[model samples]
Target: MGNETNEFDRVTMFGADWCRDCRRSKALLDSLGVDYEYVDVEADLSAADRAEAISGRKNIPVVVLPNGKHFVEPSDAELRGELEAAGVL
Candidate 1:
């Protein structure tokens, strides 16, 4: 992800490609037609640190909603609820 001021303004998901939960969430976002930023923690140490800082957990798939709320290792149903609540779904 870039260092743009608006980077986190939208729905941002910090995760690695190899993570099953990450892939599942990514697919959910895609299926819902929700726009989001995917930060590959495997590719950027700083992004990983940021994700940990946001969720206070060393877990993959830290999904930050546009409202500044975050979910760590959330299930598909949880993601769906959040997206719907955020009016993105």
Candidate 2:
């Protein structure tokens, strides 16, 4: 499906296709029907560095929420909680 705008504005996820956690998080977000920008670190040469800059760690699936809060490799429950808090769930 196309990534369209939604209540969760400016939500960006930096991840790679090969990463299991990234896939899980992506699926969770999609299943929740929230709009998010997905940047594949493997496709973009600098995306890894950008994700690291946001979370201060070299990890895939750096999820940046609309509130400017970010999570690195967050669990499903943690992600859901944040999304609920942001009124997106």
Give all candidate RMSDs, comma-separated. 4.7, 6.2
Q: Which residue runs of candidate 2 sit more than 4 Å off their true CA positions? A: 1-9
Candidate 2 has which clashing residue pairs, if any?
none
Per-candidate TM equals 0.89, 0.87
Tens digits of per-residue lDDT for model 2, 48-88:
99888777789878898877778889999999998898776
The sequence of per-residue lDDT tens digits that candidate 1 reaches over residues 21-71 is 999999999998988989999899899999988888898899988777788
Question: What's model 2's TM-score?
Answer: 0.87
What does the lDDT come to for candidate 1? 0.85
Q: Give the TM-score of candidate 1.
A: 0.89
